[model samples]
Target: MMQATTAVRGRTERAGGKRAEWTGGLSRRSFPAGFVFGTAASAYQVEGMALKDGRGPNICDAFVKIPGEIANNATADVTVDEYHRYKEDVNIMKSMGFDAYRFSISAGTGKVNWKGVAYYNRFINYMVKIGITPYANLYHYDLPVALEVQYGGLLNRKVVEAFADYADFCFKTFGDRVKNWFSFNEPRVVAALGYDDGRFAPGRCTKCKAGNSATEPYIVAHHLILSHAAAVKRYRQKYQHTQKGRIGILLDFVWYEGLTNSTADQAAAQRSRDFHIGWFLHPIIYGEYPKTLQVIVKERLPKFTPDEVHMDMLQSVIPQLKIQNMICKLVVFLIVRIMNFLIPLASPGAADERNGVLIGNRANSDWLYIVPWGLYKAVTYVKEKYGNPTMFLSENGMDDPGNVTITQGVHDTTRVAYYRSYITKLKEAIDDGANCIGYFAWSLLDNFEWKLGYTSRFGLVYVDFRTLRRYPKMSAHWFRDVVTSKN
Candidate 1:
């Protein structure tokens, strides 16, 4: 969890203040030249043409239909209508002086929705025409519903191949113009919220069946990793020379700290890191899961065949007792086993390191703590452990309750502070030799926030779902200054 300071809270409290007044004193520091600063949105979250443009049905399209699945019975049927209004949206980006526009695309195996391809091509062209580099994400939780129905979405290995095919299509279609590519956005959310908690689309499992073989989040994550790797391999082999772009995975991670200095709390904090960020990151960087995770999965997850182990070593390598190691290893293993039974909290944190706390609490709320320091630590950890591959702050923002109203304009001072604190930390990381190249705020505007739906708003711009109006919040001005000032 990212810390909400008085500055941030004060901004949120003045949700109706004049945008200029609120943004007047915010100073922006100069960032490295060509350092990208942009806002992001996804197809399912903002685009309303769910069925148009020959767009195949996505998991989100189907999942929202399930009773009690979405809040206020709201579906992203008309979201911000970005599909039809992308040109206008690009104008908005250009007017805001945005150098890059990051958006997600809808693509699946043989189910290549050519209409979607055409739509994205036009969108890409518009961004290029407007002089904004387009950063396209292949998937952002909007898995094609057809794939989910035929195969269990990310749980099945077949989905990995399908996603690769989709990536190949994207690379071939838009690679000439678009350079930056994200294989998946916040995949851990897909595995944990969609597969394990069943709170989001394709809601299948819940806490009651928590840790069940059928509900293994790690399995879903395993396939997602394979899918990401396959896309990267495809891009490197086929598109790199012609496209002149780089490929990387975007992970949502935060800083975690022990609630106290007790050994039990420290172990719990480490476990939180292992389960949240390490689950997806280890494979991408280390080519495997953390050793701690392997032990937990072995104890709690179902068994797999030798062939499965060979093919999917990333997720299937649950630790076995036969391996001989130091006494410390055994002690750590026992401690984790005990913690698993005693503590049931795990969540990702904000991208910006504020205090030194982990953020999300998909399971239990008490265990979630905001540790801004952890953001710095997490970057250092990735740099040290993953050999410092090109990295960026993929997703980072403050979540606010939506009922709060802005009489004048959307204040969102909390979000502004969140941005400042995180960006400040990000600068420190870059100064420390972390090769971070870009920063994409978690969202451009508030749209469907998965299970939280219209309840949690993390957007710099406010979206009035009823009227489909887009209003830039106070944070938007803050971010605009940051971008214009190159801070």
Candidate 2:
């Protein structure tokens, strides 16, 4: 466990003679020896050149053009131009004493266009040359427009093969030096917001339009799980001997607080848990879908033929029903009941376990959140349920308005507070026996924030989209101190 220190307090005097006292929470002691500190950025979010260097168009490129898709009518066409300025980005990371740097590949869906291959090669090589471990992610919500045009992205099983091929390309190309690999970034957001909520790219599908009546998202998730497993299998069989690396999936979760201690609210919170976090984590760690998902799929979701199943499953007996049209309904109900009995228990005490953390978005926006303590709870939950493998923060940060300006610099005190509170919880999680190996801040610079475009800022360093100048915010300096002091 990292030691704790006194919170730092300071005062700032503005040019207008207004004075403000800044008091931060307890400063964490230096991170345990060899603890990793890093920053993250995604393709499409930070890598501009949406149409340059033979880069094929991704869904984001098209999604942003739709009227009212992005908040500020901004596109990532020239976002920091990381495609051309990766060396500079590496310099920024090095200057901040970052030990690891993670970035997402923008290969449209599964096709690895030469331009993406070259761009990622440059970025990974630059990180290697600078002595920073490069942790690369296969997908970060930038599905290829071609795939969506052909088969509605994850809704089609062909995407699983395509994504596996893309992962193979990445492992073959960069696996020599870049060993740490993430299959996807916050797939829950993709499942809920994109397919179920209809707020994100590949906008509202039939499932969300039908509200809970449609089961496309679960089916899509089925495909995604197969894709991830295929990628992991490929990495293990082919790349592990040479790279000697590990592969894992990245997921986002929040701590659920029952509205009250009543059994009904507790049950509701438990359902939320199985629906949200367990949806993704269960399959990857336990080799099966969450029970709640199985129930929902069987009871409320639409069904596909045997051809629709992404992976092979054990054959089950189906009894003939007496009613003519009720056959499908009866079959589904039986399947749901069978699943309720057959789905493996998550753990002995998972349902009753509560980490005493409250998760809520800091800002009212869908992207921003203030669930600092949830970080700890998530780690502990994973530890208890999945057997604590060497884990990383994967994603953590708050979003701010990108249009703000400051003379002294980009003073994001709110972001600083967010990081401080989250880090403190992270420290507590580590002390509680979660094998948290590292931390990765969500983003490196302000860029196109998917559907929100440049409306939200989540970067430790600020990027001037007009001038393409990178300026470190107050959080950047604070992070530098944290890294330098090994906290």
Candidate 3:
């Protein structure tokens, strides 16, 4: 087990007039040696030039077309123009002392998008030229429009072989230099939101005039697990010997807590997790879905074949609020079972306040609340329940209003405090024997957030959307100290 320490606190005064260092007993010395620290971004979310240079329309390109979908009627056709300005973004990381940067391939979903190929090659070469390391993700919710138009995307088993082909190509093309890779980011969100509520690309659901919310989510999720395992199998068999790198999948899970000390609420909390994280993690790690899911979901869930079971890399995204477990279970039940034809997606968690009691600080998004201790619970739960696989707090960060002025955006004390509290609890999880190797803040720069579009900013560094300029917020400096500081 690792041990926690009383290290220097991150900077908070840069945002607010109050110049108080974080009182939490956490600092640079709290983490283990060789621990990685970095910032993360996605392709569809950050990379601009959606239709340029032979690239096809991704699901994001299609989803944004519907009226009144994204906030402010926004589109990511030119989101911070990362495709044209990756060098500038890398420079920001180099200056802030981040050890790595995680970005996904936004090109052809299956076949070669030569434009995307050239762009990623340029971006990776630049990152390697500088001191920063590259961590590439294979998928981040932007499915190829071609597949969805032809075979209904993840809903069909055909996507399994298609995704494998894509993964194989990526490993062969970029695996030599880009050593760290994740197969998918937030597969849970992709399953629930896209197939259940119709909120994302390739949108389909009972409520949206198409899709079977009850069965489609499970099918999509099962195929995603298979796809991940297939990619890992190919990599281990073919590339692992030469590339000498690790591969994994990223999952997002919010911590659950009962509203009161009642048995009902307590059971609700446990059941909610069995359906949420256990829905995917249990299958990948244990080679089967949780028993609770088997009993509750019945034949709606798919089974893995004997030859199809290959345990892949598991990366748990550690953020979001501590949900009211009773409410959480009831809501998931409604969406998962009762409201089969009236499907609704799961938001961040239960209501921000339960029965007139606020959980913690609220982020700009209604679904997220500031609950630092939830970080400890999330990591510890995965550690104890899932055999403590080598883990990374793959994605953890909160958002602020995007309409704020550049001056106000940079002086973001709320964001600074959010990072300080969450990271402290993260240290506590590490101390309690969780095998967490690294932490990646949700984003390095303010880019177009999916659904919320440009309305919610979740970046350590603020990006001037108009000029595409980068400014390190107070949290960025503190992260630099946390990651690079050696005492």
Candidate 4:
């Protein structure tokens, strides 16, 4: 107890401060010229018109309807109401000196939501008008509910066609203005959580009435990769010549470090990474899943057909297109079995703390622990392992508990420390020759946080859920200063 108390106090002294120690020496000028700074968000999390504005029901819409599925039986049906207040949100982003805004397009096909289309068009135009570059992502775990009900959603090959069509439509409509495109964000999470554990939307698992945890996650991941490749092929063959935009997929990666220097622990950490990021990236970059996965899963893992191999191989032909693997957050893991595979435990398994000392500081989220050095290790690992493809530090931020009062929320000194330390390590990675070009914070406002509902606040700006008002937090001001600094 004494040791734990001492550790907590030591961390508070280092991290809890009026200004984070790392911020004093860091500024916009500290990074290489042309580095992008922005905030990212998905449509389902922030856009509140789930049933209105001509939007169709997504898998989340259906999943949240189930009793006891989400926190407090909450739904995003009218969560933050960004659907009605985007102009205000975008203006807030502009005022923060952000150079780009990475937002997702959640348009559903089959009847076409023209009103939804018009809303996004206006949103994108206003950002462009105000000198904020737009980085658009096609899907972020919000699969059309109809697709799931009709043919098993991402598990079936049909989803590849559906997703390709959706990507094509987005390119045709918004490609001219949106130069940066991502086909899907964190498909790994979609597969592992939604299929493996039945934790996320379209929930399925072995124990559930539907889903085979062992096989479905692999099938969903295979289909997602095909969908990404198909979209890239379409953009390259049809749109790139005229539209002149770059396209990629977003992956969420957590840096897994061994508990000790023992050989078993080291191998366990590497295997965890292989199963996590490598499940998606290995096929995209090298045309197959990692060898570790191949040997371990053997017969259970789905085989890629020759045609599918060709589709996967297509991404490697385009050198300009890069992977936008978001360093969403990092974790320290001990070798553990999960979902019939030997991978890093998704939930907090291997304690973040060893010997009564926490790894860094714990964030409000159960899964997130603030370990800035983990960011450096994650980026450096991508460089060393994956041929150092051009990358983006896509989504990185800590969250506050949702119940904090606005006055308490705005004084976010800990979040400011989180950003300063994380970005400082990111610069260290860049200096170490990681081909990273951009960094996007996890979010711009406190909106619906998926299964956690509105209980976890990961935004730099505070949203008063009562009035749906926006108030910039200290972290937001810190970002503005860092971004606009001439020194």
Best by lDDT: 4
lDDT of 4 at 314: 42
Q: What are the models' TM-scores?
A: 0.79, 0.80, 0.88, 0.91
- Where's the lowest-lDDT run of ten residues in candidate 4? 331-340
On a 0 to 100 scale, what is the lDDT of residue 297 in model 1? 63
lDDT of each: 0.64, 0.64, 0.74, 0.78
**Against the correct fold, how does model 2 do in TM-score?**
0.80
Candidate 4 clashing pairs, residues 3+ apart or interchain: none
Candidate 1 has a TM-score of: 0.79
What global local distance difference test value does model 3 have?
0.74
Candidate 1 residue 475 Cα shift, in angstroms, is 1.9
Model 2 misplacement above 4 A? 1-29, 108-112, 207-213, 299-361, 364-367
- The 10 consecutive residues of candidate 3 with the worst lDDT sum are 325-334
TM-score of 3: 0.88
lDDT of 4 by residue, 148-200 (tens): 77887888899888888889999999988998888888888899889888999
Best by TM-score: 4
List pairs with backbone clashes in candidate 2: 31-486, 31-487, 109-144, 361-369, 362-369, 362-370
Cα-based lDDT at residue 357, candidate 3? 65
Model 2 scores a C-alpha lDDT of 0.64
For each candidate, C-alpha RMSD in Å? 8.6, 10.6, 7.5, 6.0
Write one digit per residue (lDDT tens) for candidate 3, span 42-129. 9888888876787788888988988899888899888988888888889888877778898898647644667678888999999999
